[model samples]
Each structure stands twice: as C-alpha cells, then as structure tokens.
Target chain A: MEFKRLNIVYGHYGTGKTNFTLNCASALAKRGERVTVVDLDIVNPYFRSSDYHEELKRLGIRLIAPISANTTLESPALPADVYSAFSEESGTVFFDVGGDDAGAYALGRYSEQILKSESWQALFVVNKFRSLIALPGDAVSLMREIEAASHVPVTGIVNNSHVAEFTTPEDVLAGYAYAKEVGAFAGLPLAATAVPARFADSLQDKIENIMPVEVLVNLPWNAGK
Target chain B: MSERVLMKGNEALAEAAIRNGCRHFFGYPITPQTELAAYMSKRMPKIGGTYLQAESEIAAANMVLGAASAGVRAMTSSSSPGISLKTEAISYMCGSDLPCLIVNVQRGGPGLGGIQASQADYWQATKAPGHGDLHILVFAPCSVQEMVDLVGKAFALADQYRMPAMILADGMLGQMMEPVVLCEPGEVQMVEKPWAVTGHGGRRPHNIVNSLFLTPDELERTVKERFERYRKIEKTEALAENYMTDDADYVIVSYGACARIAKSAVLAAREKGVKVGLVRPLTLWPFPKQDLIKAAEHAKEFLCVEMSMGQMVDDVRLAISCSRPVSFFGHTGGIIPTPAEILAEIEKMAGGNA
Candidate 1:
C-alpha cells in the first residue's frame, strides 16, 4: 500500500491519452514496480485506463475504477480508492482523466484534494490537430482554459501531436516546440513529447525537452480478407 | 517460453493476437476497447505487422476482411455503436467463409451508448452476424489471461472452420487489468494459410476471395458447407468454467464480464451458507450445452446474470433443456449489474424455489 508521485495525464479527444498512460504504466510495471491506473474518464467509450487491465494485471499493477472499485451507486461515482492509493508512500499511480473541457471539470472538483494529498504532476496532453492550437500562443490560451476549469495547475505538457496515419516527424517536433512554449507560459515543465515509433530515431536529434515514444504509432495498414 | 505478467483484458488480447500470428489490426477509436487497438498499434509495427485506425468501424472490419483473405491472422475491434457499423463486414466475412477476428468490446448499445461496460451483444455475436445461415466462432474470455488465451483459440478456430471468429467480450473484460501469462511467439504452430493472396503468378490461377456467389445453387452450397464446419466446431470447441458446483443447490450461468460479477455473487452466496455455484461459458457459439445440462441436473434452480435483457439466458435455458427452472436478471444499454445486485436477484430466485 505504498504510493509514489501521482502522474495525471489528460487531454482532448484523440490525443492518445489512454494509450500513453497504458505504455507508461507498462514501462513502470515491467520493472517490478507497483503502479495503479485510475479510469477517471467515464465519458469516452474507447480510450480509458481500464482498457489496459489485462496488461496492468500482467505487470502487477492494480487498477481501480468506479465500477470495479465499488459495486454500488447508480452513476457509479469515481470512488476515492485511487486517491487513497496515491496518498500511500511508495507505489506509482497514474490517472487517465477524460477528454473535453467538461471532463476536465470533473477532475477539477477533486484537484485541490489530490494536489494536497499527494505530490502530483498534471500533464495536459496536446495533439496539434486537436483543438485550435496550431501555434504556441493558441496552445497557451487553451492551457489556460483547461487550468481554469480544472482549478489545478497544469504542471506539465505531453505533445501527442499526430494526424492519424499522416503524422510526420515534423508534426511531432512542432508539438514539442508547442509544449515548450506552453510550459514557459504556464511556468511548468514540458514533461514529454510523444513521437511516433517510426519517427523516434529521426526526432532524437531535434527533440530537446522530450519523452520518447514508449508506445508504437498506429498507422493505416491493409488488413486483408 | 511463455512469460507470466499482468495485463488488462484488451491489452492481453492484443498480445495474444500477436502471439497467434495476427499481424494486422484495423480499428477506430472507441472506449472500453481502445486498449486492444492501441496495444496493437504500438507493437504490430515493431514486429513487422500492420495497425491502422480506420475512418470508421465499417472501414476497419473491411480492412480485417482484406487481411484475412491473405490468410494471415487479422482483427478489428469496437464498442457498441462501432460494432453495429462493422456488422456489415462481419456478415460478409461469414458469407465468404473467411478467417478473421471481430472483437466487440461491448459498451452500452442501441445507439451511441454510454462508455460504461456492458454485455448486450450476446445475440449479435452468437447469432448469424449477417444474412444467410452463417456462423462465427464466438469465444468469451472472463479475465485478462483468458483474453490472451482466447485470442489464440479464436484464430485457431476461425482458421480451423474457415469462418470469422469473435471474442464476444464486454467493456469490463476489455478494460479491467489482471495478471496474465504472455504466450511467447514461435511457440505455437502458426497455422499455414495456403489459400492466401500473397500474389498470383502465371504458375497458378488468380485467387478471388469473395462472398458474392452469383448462382443460388452455389450460395446454398456455400451455406451448407459452412454449416458443416460450424457443426464440427460446435462439437469440439465448447468450453465452460464451473466454480464450486459439486455440492451446490443452485447454479448461476453467465459469460464474459457478467460471469466475473456472477462469480462474486456465488462467493457471497457461499459465504452466507447458501449452496450456490457458477457455470461460466467460455465459448458462446457452442454454448456449453452439455455442461449446463449436467450442472442443471444437480442444481435446484439456474439463474442467468447478463448485461443484456436476458439474451444469454435464452441460450442457457435452451442448453438446460428443462432440467430445472431457469431465471434471468440483467440490465441493458451498458448498465452493469453489481455483484450485490446479482446476489439479491439470486436470493430472491432461490427463496422462491426453496
């Protein structure tokens, strides 16, 4: 029942939030480290922390969710078990919060308690194609909106910039720069930059403040009949 | 050597498919199932495989069919609405007698259902997915380890029967994490697909893998042949897990995510000194008829816990063949019945019978 620093990953829809969290959890759990993922996003049907249950289990990481954590409640509220897990002193815990500003607001209600209870880092994930953030300035404004709604300081940034199968290394680098500027504007660290697996080597030289892609890129391959 | 590790059902499924030689995955983003596609996306490319997030569920399933025709293991996944969109391709694959994996990590359904876990797709998955008398080998994994194991079995059965195979799992199974043993690749005998579209040379005639049989006679023949394969599968592939049923007075029948919740119910019932047991069907298509009938003989009553409005209950009742009174309790459109809720239903049912 030990707790490590709480890592919070959040973003807009299709920003690779769930996938990123899964890979991060996998990397930690593979090393015999105890971790937990809270599936805070009940809104998105596809990309939630719960999807990696089997992988997490394999890695000995406990997953706590509203439904799995508790059997009652009509809406099945996000139980406080995850926060409790984070408050513990040794294990790492990650929260895969929901997409959209509304989803962000859901986290805002509990942000003060989470921030107070644990040494937490909230990374606002940004995919350049998502939201109106084509440039660094636009990203800062959006970050402010997210921060305002969540009422928690956006502690870091992860550049999950990809345009489906068309994402290039250039797009990924631009995401890095965007994260840098956003970090400067928000007085936070640029935690990571999600480069596609194919472009990992190409961006090695270009990336300054970067977190290499732990997960592979999803490209459109011809799945034949 | 297979390595034992913890994995979520969806992640394990992705890994299992890779182990089963599924080299291609086509899917769109959806909750409760994104892990399967995401895991594949991350690993497939590194291992000389293909992973694509298609424009829509329709596109994803068709891409799976395309890969399947090449006689390689291929898969696509989605939640409720997305699964609905992909049914067109599922039916086509059925008609064509193609081998592939169609995973429906079911969420709330009807239309744009909520992201919560659900099991409403029992009928859609077990029944002929498309037009005609087609059959898909439907395997329901209860845990993350089972997810990996079943994906391998799904591929084997699909290839063995020359039909589409489906892991008719729900969001809970897809999203929940559990410890798993990752079966190493190169251990299992990769099924040699001789009828693949690697490329046609002048040495042999070009191969066309399609479901469009122009003549009625040919279509009928295809259906009849497919039925024969299904019958063979029905005989060989039915699997179920029975828990503490040897001295139980009542049995609960369920599958996929529902079965896990039902397991908790059985445990609670036993704790309260009620003689209850569980029969979890691992294969939905074959339906574990013999096992249900066998368990029904000793049990006083059978309760079916499902996430649907009693879809699997029908199959459970059908399987028992009137060995006992069969009852059902469920919540539809992605509403999950809690272990306590299911136990309450069980208590009510058992009381009336007692």
Candidate 2:
C-alpha cells in the first residue's frame, strides 16, 4: 500500500487509467511527497493527465508529456524530459502510459534504465466494464501483451472499474471480483481497488485495500456540472 | 419499463442492438467508438452472435454487407476517419439495397483528427455518406437513453427502407456515462427480410445482391427508384424536438451533444426573459425542415450552434429559405461551445451586448 519510487500504470482504453493516475499523483503531492507524472500517453489526444497541467501545477505535481500532447498534431515523438523521470533522486514518479500494446511500446524504449532503477511497480489497471478485457482470461492475456511490449513485469493489479458517473457500490465490488480473478490468473498481487470517494464508505465492508478517488477529468460537454 | 442502469453510451447502444436481434457485428477499433465493439465482443459470443474485429474499416463494412445480404441483422461502427474509410463499402450497400446499421461516434476531423467529441461530420452524414446521389437515414441521439432507443429504431428503419441507416453520435455521447433504461428483453419487433439471398433451392428465381450495373440505363433506373424511397422517407420520417419554441422570438437550431448545451443556454436565456427557444433535429438526413419552418413562424432570427465550424448552418438556412437573418456560432476540432458562450451569442442575437 505504500508508494513505490517509480509507478507505471497501464491498461486498455476507458479503463480509467488516466483518471486513476491523476488521482494517485494528486494524493502523493497532498501528502507532502514530491510527485511527477510522466505523460507517456502518445496514443490518445484527449483526456490524458497532461491535459490537466495547470491544475496539476497548482497541486505542486510536475507533468512531463510528449511534445504535442493535447494539441491538434498527432505527433508520436516522446519528450527528452521523460529521461529525467528515471534519474530523479527523491520524488515518486508515475508513468501514465497509453492504453494497449501500442502505447506500452514507448515504455519499452526506457527498459534499460528502468531495469537498473530502484524500487518500482508496474501496475496493470483493470476495469471489468470495459470491453476487450471483460473476462479474466482476456485481462490476463492483455497483461501479458503489456508486459511484453514494455519489457517490465507487471508486479500488481489495480481494480479501478466503474461506469463513469453511473457507477454503484455493487459495480465496484463486482469489478473487485473480476480483478481478483485476473490477478490470480496472471499471478500478480492486488495492489488496491479504487472507488469513488462518495461510495468508499458503503463499499468498505465488501472489499479490502480500497483507494478512494476523486474524478478529475471532464469532457467539454460535461462542463456545466 | 426496465430498471434503469448506469451505462456508457457505447455499451448501451451495443446492448440495445442485441435486444433488437442484431446478431452480426463487424468493426475495426477506433477511439471514442471502440467501447461499442468491445461490448459486442463480450456479449455476442454469449448470445450465439458473431462479433468480428475486422482487418480494417473497409473489411468490416464489407462484412456487414455480406451478413446483411444473408438476411441477418448486421452492423459496423467507427469514428470520423474510420467512417471515411468505410464510405466506399457503405456506398456499395446503398446501391445494393442492403439493410444494415452504421454507427459513427464522430470525432474532430478532416483528417486523422483528435479523439474528442465533435459534430463536424453533419455534412458527411446528411449530404454525402458516399459517392453517387444516395441518401441514407441518419439518426442523432443526445443522451445514453436516446442512444439505446435510437439504435433499435435505426436497425428497424434500415430494414424497412432496405438501405443503410446511421446513428450519428459524437465522442461525448459515446464516452459519457448516464442512467439508461435498456429495452426489456425480447421487446423488439423484428423485421422480416424476404428479399435476402438464401439460395434458390429450385423454389424461386435466384436473388442477386450487388451494387454493380454495367449498363448505364439500369444504373440510372436503380438510382431513380432509390430516390423515390428517399422522398417518401423525407416526408414521413423527419423527426425533431422543440423545446420552449411555443412563444419565442429567436430559435436556436442544434443537434446531438451540442443540443444539450444549447438547451441549457435556452433555459438560462428564458430565465432572463430573452424569449429564446431550441429546435433539435433528431434525424439529420430527412432533417426536420418543416419543424424549422414552423419555428420560423414566431422566431425573428435563427442561431445555429454546433461543435463544428458551422456545418449545420447551411441546412438551417435552406430550411428557413433566408426568410430571416441566420447567425452562426461554434468551435471546430473538439472544442465544445459552453452554455455560457452560447448564451452570449443568444444575447447578441437578441440585440444585447455579448
């Protein structure tokens, strides 16, 4: 449950990986711990953690993204600043990676330095509600592909499943069961199950190792609320 | 009515497809619209349906063509650029008179656009889905519940007309989560496809499904007949929703996700006694022209709001026939116009400082 020096979060699209990573970085910074989030998501243009640069900066958390992230240009060029994340001496660095194997390939380029680094955890985030990995077998297979592409072993599984704003306590618990099966099949430990802060208390008795999260990302259509 | 469950718009549309007896789904993965394919991949196997992740959008669309030709309910979906790739096969379906559903969870476009919400494909969906003088039925849904309802309707309309029908949604509608009441299991009334290619068996003449006509006269006759059907649909199937248009001076014309924001602005303007209202087009192709003409009776001017750079404005102008001055306001490439921004425009249209 304690913070790792380098935390790499990976998952399929719409698995709430970016939201989870943003919340994780914010929590660490709030705890008086130095934090930096490397926006390794070159695949997606919208809803990346880098889109929240101003908000993250106000929270004293650094975000280093690709050169053209959140821009009109679909550039695949990774920034050289990502190299500094691995070399940082005293802060907890989180790699908010892009969704599937294609996104994980970017992390493969840094495999040499990551292998020689100190304590780190490559966490595979799973949301059972998302397609492709709804089944335990599918989630395990996707984890294998992510590991193969990144050249980093997935040390843990993080159950961060919810159906956007319509998520219920039951949905979170159901995702916990699904994530547990995925962890068992992949032989990975369950790091934590995330629930929205509002429903955390209601779900406490049903699940263990709960990480309460606040939804940070919002599309333009959802601006009024 | 079924119990309401919170669902993503994409997942809800997939489940609705299943409920309506759509057993064959062919798709290629693209952002904003991938969840629908993912949902089908999981549920289709359990229900004895075919869920294939095709090699490309072109292949997937052709697969839909094959499945639909065999008398099965079939569909394919993609985002903006992916939809562009599928246009060729869609045109083939239109010419062959194949009934199928095509879902376009539109994103910012013109090229390999951003995977954000946009309504920039209105012209593409309404005017030119493919080459040739063809028109397919296009439905626009504003909410997750509407997505579920409209997908079933899209399949039915496709079959009834024996032409491709589209559910035109933006990335925002596809990705957003909201409570929705999925149709009760087995509630849908299935359409019978007697004209399908199931083999002759010496019982009847052999049926051929194709878009090709080597002779120019044959192709011209086919095109003319299809337009006849489109004309009937234009008269009977054009759908729109009027909000606060009963007694208004200025009417705002919008659709899809942008209409939601425009409705909010309309309500805010009403609170300030601006006398503004909204006319939301539900069918983009058969395009509620008569309803706009009706709204034009009381309205002094029309303001078109969209996620694109005024794509729908031309249609609004055509509908009103330049009887009143038509103004435009929007943002392109996924920058959604806010309700406040829309209200400012409404204020400006009403002769007030923006």
Candidate 3:
C-alpha cells in the first residue's frame, strides 16, 4: 500500500473497523513509520481501539482515545488531545473513528484540521455478512450517512468482511464482490481487502490488495489465532 | 448442522425474544444493554411490533406490566441502576401473577455505579426481585449462544409459571461478539392466557388482573398460594452444569460471565495435575442445590467466583449444607478477575490455605 499522512477509518459498528485500524497501525509501525492512532470511537464503550491501550503502546503506536475509554462514564467521552494528530509532522496518523453516523459525529470536530492538511483519506470499511449493512446499497447509504455527519468525504472503501472469528475464505472472496458493488454504487475505489492473517496465503493468488490482519480486540473465549 | 452467524449477546437476546413471539418492547436506553433496545427499535417497527422508549426506567417497566396484562409477550431491558427503578414493577408483576421477560444486563451498582460488567445483582435477583414473598425465575447464561438459547427458555418458562423471568447478564457478555445460531422458532405457538384482561366481547365474565388485596387474610392466602408454586418450581426447575467434577478434589462454582473465567482457570489447574472441575449454575433462583450436594461428596474444596465481592458464596454454602470448605475469590466495582488470578486462588486452596 500507500502511505497517506493521515487515514480515517469509519464504519458501522461490528463491521471490523477497529480490528482493521489496529492492523494498519501495527503494519505502519513495523515498516518503521512513526504511527499515532487516535481512537475517536466514543459510540461503542467496548471493543473499541481504546480497549487495547497497553497492546498498542507495546507496538510503539501512540493512542489518543476518549477520556472515558477505560472508565465507567456511562457515556461517550473524547479527550482534547486530538489536535495533536494534525500538528505532528513526521509520522502517519490513523483515526479509528466511531461506528455508523452516530459514531462519526465525533469525527466532525477535527474535520477542519484534516481538511486543511490535505493529506488524509477517510476509508469506509464494508462487510458483507453484517446484519444491518449486508446489502451493497445499505453499505453505501451508511457511508453517505457517515460522510454527511463527519463532513469528511470518504475517498475509498476497505472490504473487511467476516463473521467475527467464524470467518471463512469463502466469506472474504464474497466480500470482494460485495465491496466492488458498494464502490460502484458510491463511486468510491476499493482500496484494500482485509483478511485474517491465517487466510492470507491461500487468498493471495485469488485476491488483490490483501491486508492481512492479526485478530486483536476480542474476548478470551473466541480470541482468534 | 445449524449454520451460525456472529451476534453480540444483547442483539441475540433481542432477536431471540422476537422469535419467541414478543411484540411489545418497552425500554429506556442504558449502557451495555442499550444495544438490545436499539436492536428492538430497529427491528420492531419493520415487523409491525410495538417498540416504545418510555420516559424513564419506571415508565418502561410499567409499560411492560400493562402489555403483559393484556396477554401479550412484552420485554424490557436495563443495567443496574435502571433495574433498581424497575424493581417496584417487578414486585407488582409477581403479585399479579403476570409473566413477562425482564432482562438485566447488569453493570456495577449500589447507586449509579460504573458501566462495566458486574454480577452484583445476584442477591437483588434471586433473594428479593420484589418486596413480597415471591421468587422470580432467574437464568444466568455464560456465552452469547447460551444467551440466545436461554431467552427462549426464559420466556417459555415465565409464561408457563405465570411469573416474571430475568436473564441476569453483565456487560462482558452483552458487548462481546460470538458466533451464535439463533433458534428459528418458526410460528411460535403462544401459550393461551385465559386469565388475561383481553376484551371479553360480552361472551363471558371479564377477567380481572389485579394485585390489590384489601384484607390481610386475603393477602396472606395469596402469598401462601404463590409459595406453593415456588416450592414446585424449586423442586423441578433447578438447572446446573457439571464440568469434570466426577473425580476432582477441587470444584469451582460460578455463573454468568464469571463462570467462563472460572472454567478457563479450572482447565489450567487440571493441566498442572491438580484435580479440579467447574460447576456452573444455569438457574440462580432455583439455585441448583442438588448438583452442589452431589459434588460435595467427592470434591473436598469448593471455590465461588463472581464479578462482585463474593455474593454467590453464601448460596454455595447453603446448597452444600456447608459440607466442604468453600472459598470466595472475586473483584467488585466493575473489575473482572482474570483467569490467572482465579487459578492462583485455586492453587492456594489446593495447598490447604483455606
């Protein structure tokens, strides 16, 4: 892939956006790029990027999360340090935006700085097996909703489809077709196809732009390999 | 083979209730459990069902009481503080002998505690769901799939027994995603509510659904009659799962989300040549006393693990008649104990440290 100075990831909740964001941040850090992950996901109290604060720090990725990320605030709370993402000049920054339009409303706060920099790409993650956004039309409409709420135009779509830990190769292949449909409907380019790292080798011959990700941000029972 | 789809516990509970013929859902959004209501709000309208977000938790519980009196399946969900507001309605439901599903996706509590998962409501659920001398059928499911399975059973048993049923879940199960094959209960054959307050159509005497008994004698009679049904339920409805307890020296007793952590710890202990097992309670109200008595015969020690500061330990002792040396290990105030911590506790118990 390509390295934009900043990358914004937004999608419907449970669409594997956080997992994809973590994968991207880890990959960027491994490639020796200074990476800072701003977790703007106040919509979901759990399973967000903030839950992996220690893990992210161990990977040399700085995280800017909500004030109530690891606390019991009973509401979504964001920190004021989000402005630093715009000021930092050397490393790649990734904003793990919230889920859906309701979640993306948080991203609207920093949309001005992101626009002024002119070095960012807002990617909408799409999943084929999710219940509410299973259809290509539903996915595009949600993308439109996020764009309208965040005031940041989504430039590309990331096809990160799976049934949680139950993802099969068949689901990833089918997701490529689904992502293409969503891209056509919304006139956005398919930027990447996210596959769990275990399935990356078998799918390399058949799939393109494969972003193999380690499954983090999960429960102990079904914590995938 | 049943094809499974990934679903959060809260979503699975909402979908399972819908499949079991629940048409009315009254809810006030609260954290962790809010997704269940969100799911209901999204799906209820599409199915021509009633999804009303009441003004407060009190209003939501009353709405369920009203819908349940009209002989329809109704449900309401909330966390700890919210569940506290609904307790009055729960007592009234018990007094009126009305059956409705009440889901408590619990968070830390005492008064408006934190939003993370906690089993602090065990006593509130099993001992006194309401003020009167009544017992609500309570189920504690440990997995997302079990959450789906028990929602149907909870609704069915509630209707059968003519009392409120609660799914005592916590934030961990509600937020975690897992693959669950939702039971497609096609064409739900609803149980007939002959004593319901449905319009009579002038064919027969109108049914009265009331909890008000003016005279003390009449109230006592009602209490005694409810106790008789409770006795039968206690005898027949207790459910527990015994994991590798056949020849074990130490047994861990847990329920709900804590049980999963306990099971993992038990496995680790067993791998180290320490004889250990887990006895998980599926029903909290019935308490599954017989299973504990059976385990007490072989296991020399028992450990009660919970998310709260050892709330379920007393029940374990009462179940086993204080036969074995029972130890309690837990964390309260929204802290979940890790498997290693629990395993360390097991090791201490194994070394006869208490």
Candidate 4:
C-alpha cells in the first residue's frame, strides 16, 4: 500500500479524529511532502485540523478557503483555487470530516468526486470511549452507512482509544489492534494508528507506521492556550 | 468607479477579506454564518489561500489562533453559541496581545436560539470574552458596505493594536444582499506582523505562543497592559454616525440591522410632526458614548428599537446616563420589527404616552 495516498480521516465527535488528521498532515508536511488539508467538519464547535492553517502554510503546504478579510470566518464552499490545486498532480490531501453523521453527510455533496477519483483513501477514525457507536460491529456498520451516504467507502480504520490527556502508547496499540480487526472484517485495510502528541518519541518503537499527534487538546484552540 | 453587486453579507466579507490581503481563515460551520464559510471554501483555494471547515467551532477558532500567532492575518467566525464556545480562545488571544479578527453574526439567545437575527450577545461580546481584564475591540457593521469596509478595518486595527478585533454583526447582516463596490485585490493595505510564530530556524530562539497564567500577579499584569491598549483604542476607534439629529425632538439609537430599520423609522416620523433623528453606533464596544450623550441633550426622548427585547436599550441608557426618557420597543426570539412599529413607538413617546 502507498504509505501516503491522499488520506481522509473522519469520525463522530471527540473520537480523536482531528488528532489523527493533524498528526498525519503535520508528519507528511514535515517529511517534505506537499500536503493539503480541508476542514470539512461543519458540526461540533472544536477539535479540527483547520485550526492549523497558519502552521500548515508555514510548513509550505497550501491552504484553500474563502477567508480573505480578517473578520470573515464564513466557511462558504471549496474555492476555485482548491480545485485547481487538486487538478494538479500534487501531494497528499487530507479532508477532515465533522463528528456527527449529519456533518459527515455534508461531505456527500462536496467531496463525491474527490473521493471517487484515484488514489484517495478514506480512513474512518473511531474511539470506543465515546457512545456514538461502540464495538467493531457497530463501527463497521457506521462505516458502511457513511460509504453508502457519501458514495465513498472507508478504505481503512484508525483506533483512537483513550481519554484526553490520559491516552498512552499502549492504549493506542490496543485501539490499533481493534481497528485492524474491524478493518479485516469490514473488508477495508487498517491503514494507520494515532498516539497522542505528548507520548515521547521513545514510544515510536511501540507501534510501527502510525501517526503521532503533537498537540493534545480536548477543546478547540479558540481559547488561545 | 464603485460597482454595485447584489451579494450576501457573508460573501461580501469574503470578497472584502481577499481585497484586504487577509488570506487565512479557519472556522466551523454554524447557521446564519454558514454562507460565510461556504463562500470561503469556494474561494480561498483558488486564490492561493487556505480554507478548512474545521471539525468543530473550537477547532476553527484555534486554527485562527495558530494563523494569528504566525503573524498572518487570520479569522474565525460563528454565531452566539459558537462565540460562547470560542471565549476561552478569544481570552487567550487578548492575553497574548495577538492581533486577530473574530466575527460574531449575532443570533437570538442565551442557548441554541433560533436562526433569525438578534443582538443578544451585546454583553458577552463587550464584556471580557474570557477571564481577564482585557477588552476586545468590537466593530458593528450597519450594512453590506460596512461589512466589506469594516473587514478591512478589522485587520488593520487588529495589527495596529496587536489586539483581537471583532465584527459584531447579526444574521440579518450575514444574510442580507446589498449593492457594494468590489475592491480590487491589491488596493487594500495589509498589516505587517513581525510577532508571528513562523518557526525558529536558528535565527531566533523558539517563541512560545500560549495564554497560560500560572501566577495571579503575572496574569493581572498582562490584563493591566491589555487595558492600556484598550484605553488607547477607545480614544481612537470610537465611531458613530448621526442622522438629522440637529433640531430634532426625539432620537432613535440603534446598530447593525436595527439601525437600518430605525433610519426608516426616522423618515417615517419625519413625515409626521415628530422630529426624530438617529445615533447609529459603528463600534458597539467603547460605544458611541459621547455622541449618544450629546444627542440626548437635543432630543427630548430616546427610543431604542431592536429585534431583541431591550439589548441595545441598556447601552443607550448607560451611555446617556438616563438623561432623557429612554423608551424601548422590540421583539425577541427572531422576530424582526418593522419601521412602522418603530415609528409608532416614536409617536407614542413623542406624545408623552411612552
């Protein structure tokens, strides 16, 4: 499997969805791969990858949005420039979907073409702790539902199993294993895993080919800290 | 020549943001402000900028914080509930003295209020957004033209003061379609930011971007300094517009969409014997205190008409110090009052029946 196909990370609220996407986007961008991240989560009020627009821009990754004036925070639609970038044979693109199934439903319209286009991998992120859906069976069902709705299949799964500020490499590994089993049963690949950003780099040996989140924030960054 | 184009307030802001050289945006989608986000999504990428519909409003605001810390012009927007969620982040921006733009498309409520327009957020916005003595400069746009012009001003004031500035609008402002001049992309000036965290590449030590106050005294000091900046802002940025106030007997004080409605009321009252004028505030915070006070002296009574029950009425009473009979007539929960309603209120108040 390509280590970095155009990856998509999505799930319900508080499920370590952004943690996974940001880590992957940061890691990919840091590795000198041109990366583009679209913040498509229209529901929930926090914990999204779009919060790192400046950081991504500084890292040489292009950001596409409708924000031109300082006070204009209106998330209109995918700007013409984003499609231009997508049209070019470019680096990895990470589209972060919202937490609720309703938010996920929004992707059905805007991202249908992008999802069906070649080399796009949609990774469904899940955390067992949250009650949106539990058990591998439930996750698979949710994935199938999302795929049917968006006309896009979940290419893989990532287990973000832990409480905020309390997640460890072991928890991540356990979640990864769970995700792998779900992926196997769902007929999708277990693409990757996510360890909290604070886990020391020494823990990198705990899991191979996984993403590491640098920031562990339970709330959205709007609070500035 | 300024061309008139029919466009939504949010789209106008998008066009203005681009014209003003503000190329960064981070936000989650909320009602009444969704058009803004939708517009950004469609335009940002085409112009070599960034747009992301954050997983949540919190994430969207932090994305703005990150971009602002990097010294690039950035913004996040939402309605009242969304702004309530963003208080923690907004407080931090104030504490850090990080210049940024925050747009609150005012909606009704203390909770998940209806999607229609209301200005119930006057207190939360003017009050310290979070726990601090810090003040956020609030700009209230009265029309689509002001939405565009104020966006440019929002960025400039943000950079100049190194403070967070807000465009306090309502759903009416966000959804209204009005004729506006399309500013050429290069004409608007961009603020220079030297304090952005663009990564320390051996040129300087790592710059920590945060808003933590471990010590009370330290936090207090930061707040005091922010207050100093606020005082300076108050002196320079207080803005208001007067309409036919001279020799008028009664004045209508309002802002945002309500102000537009009140303007019509003034004309309607003028057709009658009631000499009514207007004192429309452009900056809701640091409000047009002096002008309101001055207008109160000439006008026998001040009528505060709003979509909300009495949000702006309190501000007028506070500003005028209850010098005149400040009567209020309004509706709450997304009910828009017509100019006729306001004119009736003016007539009643003028007839000494208020």
Which scores better on lDDT, 1 or 2?
2
Q: Tens-digit lDDT track for model 4 on B240-329?
A: 999999878888888887787788778877877678899988998778898887887778888877667676777788888878878888
What overall lDDT goes with each candidate model? Answer: 0.74, 0.88, 0.88, 0.73
Superposed Cα deviation of residue A147, candidate 1 (Å)? 15
DockQ ranking of the models: 3, 2, 1, 4
Which of the predicted structures, 2 or 4, would earn the higher DockQ when compared with the native? 2
Candidate 3 lDDT tens digits, A111-214:
88888886889899988877678789988888898999999999998998888768899989988999999999999899999998997989999877899988
CAPRI quality of model 1? incorrect
Report the C-alpha displacement of residue B35, candidate 2, in angstroms.
Answer: 6.3
Fnat of candidate 4 is 0.00
- Candidate 4 residue lDDT tens string, A1-225: 244445667775556676677667677778788777767665532234555567667887765533421222334344455455355455787777765455677567656566556767788887754433546887777677777666666767776666455555666666777777777878877666666656746566766655666553322111223
**Per-residue lDDT for B235-283 in model 3, tens only?**
9999999999999899999998888888888888888888998999999
Interface RMSD of each: 16.9, 3.8, 3.2, 19.7
Distance from true position, residue A97, model 2, in Å? 2.1
Best by DockQ: 3
Residue pairs in clash, model 3: none
Which portions of model 3 show Cα errors greater than 4 Å?
A74-77, A88-90, A220-225, B185-187, B352-354
Per-residue accuracy of model 1 over B204-252 as CA lDDT, tens digit each: 7777788888899998887788788778877878999989888889899
User: TM-scores across all candidates?
Assistant: 0.66, 0.85, 0.96, 0.61
| Candidate 2: stretches off by over 4 Å | A131-134, A177-189, A199-208, B1-67, B78-92, B107-117, B131-133, B143-145, B171-188, B210-228, B247-249, B267-275, B320-323
Writing each residue's lDDT as its tens digit, candidate 2 over B1-354 gives 865555678888898888888999999999889879988998899989999999999999999999999989999999999999999998999999999999999998888878788899998998999998898999999998899999988988999999999999988888776667778766888777778999889999888999999999999999999999999999999999999999989999999888989988988889898999999999998999999999999899999998888998888988989898888999876788999899999998988633
Deviation (Å) of B295 in candidate 4: 0.8
